[model samples]
Target: MSRELRLAEVFVELADTLVDDFDVLDLLHTLCERSVELLRADAAGLILADQHDVLQVMASTTEEARVLELFAVQNEEGPCLDCYSTGEQMANINLDEVQQRWPRFHIATAEFGYRSTHALPLRLRGQVIGVLNLFCAEHAVLSDADVKLGQALCDIATVGLLHERVVRQGEVLAEQLQGALNSRVLLEQAKGIQSERAGIGVDEAFTLMRAYARRTNQPLRTVAEAVIDGSIAADELKRPR
Candidate 1:
């Protein structure tokens, strides 16, 4: 498909999250995957603030990106952190030049073979909830158009995350975000179990589980819980044909 058509499709997919079965984890993962494809980034990842205002890795396009995001959180430094704190976009940052600004983050970026990155805040109005991060393998800068597109994607995702239902019911945004973070932990455990049982990589295991959830018209978290409790066998998560 052409880039414009695919970009439109991505917007539709993100808008679909407004439904009752909306899965925050699935939505964030899809955002990361689409960001890489549409922005021509080597990898992408998302980090969201938990109830206590702590950043946690929510989704990533690759394992390396996931690990680097975690490193950023643990060390309390990185473009994502800076973007979140400032509620501004950090675009086309060369890792080699940012060593003095983010010493540890620079080192971790080098270790992951990422030469540049962009961090966009997942914000609406004045409230910032998280960050969407893009990593490039080459020391490159995003065009102004790409930066605007990335920020637009982030804005759509943030709106979906804080959907009107939460406000209509007077639900706390932090509590809802915390629920998604908790679901991520269960997903990790389930992925490991599926990997062992099916002799597959963790990434593949997650793919299978996600596919099974969609096939069954269930939430990803529900499928994950079933796998953890032995209610869903590893082999049952067949790849969608």
Candidate 2:
């Protein structure tokens, strides 16, 4: 299919989140995947705020991306953190030159071959709820088109998350945010189980879990739960299809 058609399909899926079975973290994961597919980015991730507005890595395209986002939260620096804090987009950042601005973030991102970064805030009701982070391996700045598309996707996701519950946005949003964070924790546990069973690294464990989830058309969290509870055997997952 053409890229445009694929993007249209993705937008349709994004719209579907509004009407039913809305899983916030899954939706955000889809956004991250589609962002990497459709944008100039090589990797994408999201960081969401909990009830206390503390940033946490909600979803990422890879284990490396997840680690980078988590490092941002742990060290209190990075484009995503800044974008969420300022409620503004930080685009076309040259990671090589930002060493002084974000010492640890720059060094870590450089190790991952990321030279450029963009962060778009996922804002709702005049409040920043999360951030869509995009990175490129090349030192290329994102075009205007890239920024517009990224911002549109971020806005759609934010609105879908807070839809029809604007009055009690605080409680509803907070609950959903907490749920996403909890899902991440469960994913970690599942990764550990998969790692033990497969004799692989945690990164490989997570990649395997995500692959199983996609292959089975199951929500990632559901697959993780099954893995954690032994309902789904890691040996079964390890065997080739």
Candidate 3:
């Protein structure tokens, strides 16, 4: 498919999420998957700032610790953090030369054998909702066109992911009636439970839960309930192979 056609189809897929089967996790997964396909990247991941303004791994194509760790390193410093903070794109970064800037992220990506990365802030209009990180295998570099395409994908997808079908009543609490907000709350709780029980950080816990949800073809909240109820053992949801 032409890139334009593929991007149009991706928007359609995102619109399908607002129906009764709205699954935020799946929407994010689609964003990452389409990013890799359209941008010619090895893998992609999304980091969403939750209600608390803390960045969390919302979705990723791979669950490898090395790969997840690459995202985690951004919690302190990296292209993703900078892109998100500035609401700007950080494109075609040569990992070797960034040793002084993002030392840990640089060393970690090098150790994983990935040499370049591009990060785009998930901004729409004037609001930056999240960040998208694209990892290129080998000593790969993205063209100026590729960088623009990546940012376009991020901006377009942000609309669907945050479309806020919030229902309001003069007598009702807004958060109670907002499905998207409710989902975010459950996501945070699940992360905390998994982290506490499994002895891992919230980011790693989310990775494990997200990996398990994808592996079993289940909705994120269903899998989260299982984890909370002890139905899905944390050990069973181990990092993806």
Compared with the true structure, all predictions reach lDDT values of 0.89, 0.84, 0.72
Model 3 Cα lDDT, one tens digit per residue, 1-241: 7867877887677667655455766677778888888878887878777656666666677654225534564457788888878998888888766677888777777776677888889887777777888888866678888788777777667765555553222322223224444565677688788898889988779778877887877888888888888887778888465
lDDT of 3 at 175: 30
Model 2 lDDT tens row, 31-147: 998888888688888988898878888888877888889889898988888898789889989976668789899999999999888889998767889898888899877789878
* Candidate whose TM-score is highest: 1
Quote model 1's TM-score.
Answer: 0.95
- Runs off by more than 4 Å, candidate 1: 239-241
> Where is model 2 more than 4 Å wrong at Cα?
165-171, 200-204, 207-219, 238-241
By TM-score rank, best first, the candidates go 1, 2, 3
* Tens-digit lDDT track of model 1 for 64-122: 89899999999988888889999999998997666978999998899888899999999
User: Which pairs of residues collide in candidate 3?
Assistant: none
Alpha-carbon TM-score of each model against the true structure: 0.95, 0.88, 0.70
Worst 10 residues of 2 by lDDT: 164-173
The residue-level lDDT of candidate 2 at 168 comes to 56
Model 2's TM-score against the true structure: 0.88
